[model samples]
Target chain A: MRAAYRPGPDAGVTVSDDGMSVYVARLPGGPLLVLDGAAALIWAEATTAPATGWVARVAELVGQPEDAITADVRAFVADLSARELLVPLGGDADPPTRA
Target chain B: MATQEATGAPSAGATVPLEVRIGFAHASVQWIADRCGADLLHVKGAALDPTLVPGRGYSDADVLARPAHVRRLLDELPRHGWELINTFVYGSSFEHSATLRHQDFGLLDLHRIYPGTGPTPERAFDTLWSQRTTKVLGGIDCPVPSHDAQAVVLLLHAARGGSDAKAANDVEWLWTSADDAARDRVLDWVGRLDAGLAFSVITGTLDEHRDDPAYDLWRVAARGGTRMEEWRARVRAARGLRAKLTVASRSVLVNVEHLTIVRGRPVSRAEIVAEFFGRPARGLREQVSRLARRSRR
Candidate 1:
């Protein structure tokens, strides 16, 4: 099972009301990052729960086969994790309860 | 800190929106204040509760720090890319807020006092802080004055806003058309904050406060005044012999920081000398014209 993700402790995130863009910044200072297009789609799915098939959800949103986009999505998530803007929840940590 | 600029954009050439930048500015300051253990209330601009006036636009972020915490916040702001462009003493007639600029977040006004409030800053902060609530800005839960207190603060801002269309519009929506209960709540805050002197401008009872020390300050602010009148009013409003002297002295000095911004670079000493001499002549011209107009009337 893949680890779920959540915004990092210092991350300040705002998704536009239209859901077309996600603005993220590191607090105490910033170089604000705007994520849109496929990046926005990936962020939306990665932070939502049932982390099991999160990459597949991204693929579904972009209307591409899961296998084709899986490697790229992982790379993007890793980049965000390295920047400390997103954190991978431990396997034992509770998946956010769905509404 | 993950605050470093991203070297690559996921999508090419996507510029951050102005409001988004402002939101990040709020988040940046809140983070700084938290680290410094300072108390601040995000007010006006982006922090304002949107329901108060729908579609009201704002260009920058404004935050009010507890009076005692202001110096500490100022000391810490620069470490986070918040450059102090204008100190409070030169900020305005009230000397209330310092202007800071950030590389990614545009402009911010860090207020030590929310002009028109107070018999004193400490008491005024306590009154507002006691009823504070939180609002999310830049995805961080930020403290803000309560709904009713916000109404009072907004009205006070409009009261000194002179003939600014936006200020008048704020008054029309937040005061003129507000129901009696809303008015009562705002009045209660005004009394608690001891903001009656300035609030009188909104009530159109400004002439009644002629004897007040700060009366000319508010009068000049609300009705507009020539540069000479403004300095005279500032001198009159300053509390003590020392403070009045300070205001009077500053009225004659050139603001180097403002000059730098206007010129978009560090100014030369020669330029400073030129402006120093030029300002008094300009102030005198304005004063003379105003006097002539008054006599003609």
Candidate 2:
């Protein structure tokens, strides 16, 4: 199922000052993950507000057509979801703001 | 494909900004504290009210737990990723906090007491907790002392900071440049916390409290003293004879926990024995040099 994503309830995330990297950790204990380049952009767009057409936004940001990036983006998001770092949005909820 | 690196335990240096790492550290500790049903107030460092000291930089997370809950929090911390790198006694002369490190989140100082506050730690925690507010760190709504109470805490920390420029800057922003009302608010908290003896360092009246047992402790802290002098002050400030003896005894013993941190590995028993004997001679040398410098001056 194609679903919008938000940072998982158990994840703690911080983005680099340049917006080029995203650091994510599972709560309490961790396998801290650093995502950069297209991955960082995907994580940022996927978890942003409106929770719709997020993958398309990532395609635009990276200067690629939606079709060209769709499969890869889905695969990346799926990877994160499996790790519980990012979760599919269940409803019309806004993404969280990082501190 | 966007590159992703899974850092099980990254090198000593981290690519993540320290503030960001510290924010996550606060969140992690807050998570552990909640599951254990313990209360903790994030303080100073990343927890400071941003308005009190503009652009203050902190290298670590600092949290003050209720005195009664400290032991439980200590026990539960290991269940999380926190490794106790330094025990409270070795953390500083005050013995107010223990230092722990996280593989991913860097360092956290779990303070049982915020030095300079409290006729008692229990009462001090209550005084700050009663007027608490919240700040979002790493997307977690962590409890912190009220803005005014933070101002007091910062000032107290600055009192013990000696000549550190950062401490001086904190004093400038929170106290020296503040208006009469802001000053009054800080003084009120100091009174409530029974922190007058220490806060006197900030007011330039430390001499007036010469009779107070803790006065020398504040004296050496606010005005850089030798290791020998610092240990003497700690012994004097200890409440009972047993505590005083404990503090005195600790002066000559090797702090193996501290040695581990300094060497970046656990010390051999022989290393510990060598340090145990070497420390007294080092203290004596430092004392002699200090006296010689004084005499020459």
The clash count of every prediction, one per candidate, is: 0, 0
The digit string of per-residue lDDT tens for model 2 on B2-82 reads: 434455435523566778788989999998898898899999998987888989999999999999999999999988879
Per-residue lDDT tens digits for candidate 1, residues B1-297, read 122243245332236778888888889999889889999999988889889988889999999999999989999999888899998988899999999998778899999999999989988999999999998989888999999899889899998899999899889888899999988888999999999999999999999999999999999999999888889999999989999999999999999988999999999999999999999999999889999999999
What's the chain B TM-score of candidate 1? Answer: 0.95
DockQ of 2: 0.52
Model 2's alpha-carbon lDDT is: 0.86
- Maximum-TM-score candidate: 1
lDDT on C-alpha atoms for all candidate structures:
0.86, 0.86
For model 2, what is the alpha-carbon lDDT of residue B104? Answer: 75
Decoy 2 TM-score against native = 0.92
TM-score per model over all chains: 0.94, 0.92
* Candidate of highest DockQ: 2
For candidate 1, the per-residue lDDT at B57 reads 91
